[model samples]
Target chain A: MYDARIMPKPAPKKHLSAKEGESAGGRVTVSIHDVASAARVSIATVSRVINNPHLVSARTAARVQEVIRKTGYAPNPFAQGLITRSSRVLGIALPDIHGEFYSELLRGADAEARSLGYHLLVSSEPRREDRGPANGSLAFGLIDGIAVMITDAASNLLKEAKGSLLPTVVLDTDLHAKGVDSLVVDNAGGTREGVNHLLASVPASSLYFVGGPEENFDAQQRASAFRAAVAASGWKPRADQVSFGDYTSEWGERWAEEHLKATGKGVFGVLAGNDEIAIGVMQAASQAGVRIPDQLRLVGFDDTRLATLIRPRLSTVRVPMAEVGAASIRLLVRRIEDREAEITCVHLPTSLVVRESSVPRA
Target chain B: MYDARIMPKPAPKKHLSAKEGESAGGRVTVSIHDVASAARVSIATVSRVINNPHLVSARTAARVQEVIRKTGYAPNPFAQGLITRSSRVLGIALPDIHGEFYSELLRGADAEARSLGYHLLVSSEPRREDRGPANGSLAFGLIDGIAVMITDAASNLLKEAKGSLLPTVVLDTDLHAKGVDSLVVDNAGGTREGVNHLLASVPASSLYFVGGPEENFDAQQRASAFRAAVAASGWKPRADQVSFGDYTSEWGERWAEEHLKATGKGVFGVLAGNDEIAIGVMQAASQAGVRIPDQLRLVGFDDTRLATLIRPRLSTVRVPMAEVGAASIRLLVRRIEDREAEITCVHLPTSLVVRESSVPRA
Candidate 1:
């Protein structure tokens, strides 16, 4: 079974005469002409053999194959890169490997990469805590592409990278780098939908929106939607409705406690940045003798694994992780395959997942 | 900010320096000396700079470095098969990219390579359906070294590979190939401890193990521990106590349902191979009206994030994913620095985390 499957292998790249603009990096760094010279074969013969070979005599093909294999010839990667300069690998550097969002993104990227037979090289924050741009040193390698999660893809690192690396696809982050792709979710739209769903069904008089990282794109986008949702509902609550933090569960719990302790508190609904913050909100609410949904129509963003696992099952706006992963890979690989392929940007869809966390607030 | 962290950087070659021994292929194809001369550097300079660089001056180092860089030089990768050759990129092939385990490992390996100014070349499964060894076609000119997962190391693609082709390290899958430094999690001990934990916590009357891939070493070891745990507790539910799968949550849920259907029975506790399987089991149990801990106890291996994310938080044996990741990088890099240092097999400790999942069966 395995042998049969191995027979029809992916054909090696043909060093065709089809011309490509020399990447400002000189052409012929390691050319097919060199392999042809050492093997003493016509360039056409080599190209013909590489692309389609039943036409060649067995003897001629074997000799060429020997030389090519012996030289460890740079054909596929080099030829592909020359044509599109897209690195087949999508480079994503994150701050920590322990997060659910990162893991989900990896899964999404994996599914997409596997469909295309590409891979991702993951590098976390450097071991030496002193290292600046922990993954900047890693960026020098050949990659057809890259995908950066905005939270992990801090602006500092993006602002200071070597010129002419892989074409990047940014996920949920602002990008200033020219010639790169950016894909952000409809953070505002999704959050607004979630809030409207809760307010339409719930009888809560006042609502609050928990926020995430101060300068975070998703956090800011979600907060804007929350403000709009509250305004549309014609409910006038205090300015203290927004509580910001790093989107940690700790922040969720702490904010809940602080709200409960504050004078004349009316916090009823919380629209959190992501699921982690939602978890903290739930835990804190539970301990503070506040019931979920009944007492607070809570909603979270990025419906990760934590959503279902939590009690009262967190209602959230599914940020479409798999979509981002698939889109990023496709955009990056296309960039690698066709240089003139205009830099592509995609806004993947998100939806509200109504579960037990937010229901008709009675 | 980026100039600083230049500090870090595996193999399969039983006869790397045996000048008199016949290579498995009976050919000494290329030598480092030839590469040095072609690049215009002295033999000692190439040796110090290439093999061990404790003795080279900075100015000569720059010139020699430029020459080697220009020549696109590398040491022989097919150690015993073809004598003299070089490819600078270190190739890593991964089974999947989505899991916490694999991502953390990639992070570890990337960290090590980046420190030593080495670039990484990565590929997903060349064939999506075929899980066999990688065809030699992907092995061409891209990498100077290789660190493989070794899941299919027993296959010909692995057996036929030249040990000297690159510096190679096998991760977790445990192929003790000659001249290859391997990093494996001590599955036997980790499983034994997990099984022992189950025995201590659950009732003696009922116990079962839901295992991973039958061919997997990690699964087999864990299964064996189940047998030992049962014997110590003087309980043998049945020889059919074991259920097989690919360590996925889907399979775990399926197996749990099937087991519940058959024999019209319920076990006191379920000891599973991984967090994925445990999740499956939990999902199945909840659907079947089986209350966790109160009605049944459960424990799983690999204290993955999913364990905590799930309700009645999984009481699992922590596999120390971060430690495994950090340690593997250090071990591989240290091996590169000094090969004679024992072919180390590291076993980062596993701890049992008792949560609501495995409360003393009420």
Candidate 2:
């Protein structure tokens, strides 16, 4: 299990032979060729015995094992992978790998993958456009399947992943493609609850919707839900009352700063697309001397850790990010194991968590 | 580039042959064997031409590539990796991956790894002991090298990683072994600055240190620095003033709640092990009607995002977590590229970010 000589120094450039048993120092090492000859079997047979022993005959496997033990022949993992055609690795492609939301999702995905005897090969690149055909080949070559979290509806990543013809699971997006499984948070339902919670405290006309990126599917669902909920309450939101921007605190702060300067004195309700945006609004409102739940009431989406840590403890829609991550892996694995399995589009439910930011203390 | 037929369904169970060119439906596909025969070159030469093109003669590589294009034969990545003995993947093993600190560190590491043409294979398991020899082999079989972040000084992860004899870089720990490079934050220097800042406002005896897990190297360093700084102020702190617990807000809250109950009404200073712990202390003190800075001034380490989100904006020590992560990969890559490179330990500096939590606003 603990062989020090498993990986010898890489052979010199001049030595172009495919054999890995030869050390750079001109030392003779036990090769798979030697094992196959000793066992009176082909090299492929020896590899199958090492990587997929169940596939080989018991008598032949025993003979190969005996020869391997006697010869001190350590099988190269790459060779084993080549014969098995299974790397036991899952590729994960996300919009970004930073922040609490992504962290929790990754944590869940990682745990599920590990439990299922698979390791995660996370794409470190953040930009979607940068991951071209080369990256698709890289993913196809390395992993059995891939789990892609598509934040932007317009992203070509989902199409590219589908094009790779590898089993795939799409996360946090509403768009559906053939031969792909999807796991999405109930964004509209959660947004409706958040809007109603805010409407209960403040007038619907004073309500504002701060959305995520325009191309984001979750953001679109949430924004649409906010409009529908407001309409049901018999109030139509003005065009100026709704805004869309990237899901960052900076964007939220900028929008709030401008809104506060324009509407200097009014009690209003805000439904931010996500927690980070809500936190930004809270910061801007605080700086402007607008007391929370007094001059401004806010509800955030994705009950991140920051929701509880903030002063007026933000009210938020709790998206089960970790559960979604785990579910994505399960779905992807199912698809990989049985390519003919029915395509699934799962929607995990979300609930609203009411806190001091939405309702003033009695 | 978007070849739909790249991966056919797996062959039937009874088809024990190592060849991947035959589909389960009995369709004949172009294989590497065909490409090699067509080009009149050895299979190994064809593989080298595809994977390590520089190692093959320009004329031979062109011939093989042309044959591959004409035959529409896509080289199996596993076969390519087997020939070159390079996966172009880096493994990352962290104690935990579900927090802001770890997220930021991963983001940095991921970015750096991508820039270096390597993807990260992050170990999903959280516990150290669960990663036995089997896990070690899995890692050794998959990645070219690894970056391990050791939180607990007592953790055998470092030892096991060393035993694997793979090129490794240890992060955020003081413990060092031969042949393994290390990258650590300047915990002591940052702690000293935090302590002196608090001492200028409050008496040294009234100061308390709420540390992370006793086994954690960073926690140990911060605690020692606190003691040294207090002693430098010509004051001896009671043993009761210092405490060690896990780096969570619950521990900070629990410790502060108990301390408040025991020593009820005077102003004091606290130096928490990390931002999470500091936020916990703040929450408990707030619930108990203790005002930050005015009643209980505090400082924390690892200026995480929570530091600013919490009320009064926590004064904290800023560990360059992202830079530390990037540096670890750089060191590991250096070691992986040059086996005989000098094993060096790098300490990135930390600084104090003073905020409203530590000083009363004028």
Which candidate has the highest lDDT of all? 2
| Regions of candidate 2 where Cα sits further than 4 Å from its true position | A1-75, A128-138, A175-177, A260-267, B1-75, B128-138, B260-267
lDDT of 2 by residue, B174-278 (tens): 444555688889999999999999998888999999999887778888999999999999998789878999888889999999997876577789999999899
Measured with C-alpha atoms, the lDDT of residue B325 in candidate 1 is 51
Summing lDDT over every window of 10 consecutive residues in candidate 2 chain B, give the lowest-scoring window. Answer: B12-21
Candidate 2 on A1-362: residue-level lDDT in tens?
A: 86759978566344233244444664334567878877888888998898799999999999999998886666666766777667889998877733888788888888888878788988644565555455542456678899888876566667767766678899886444554688889988998898898888788999999989887788888989899999889998788878999888888999999998887577789999899899999999999898998889999999998888777889999999889889999988988898888888999999999999989668
Model 1 chain A weakest 10-residue run by lDDT: A17-26
lDDT of each: 0.66, 0.82
List the DockQ of the predictions in order.
0.15, 0.49
lDDT tens digits, residue span B168-229, model 1? 56666555446556677766776666677766766555677888888766777778877876
lDDT of 2 at A19: 45
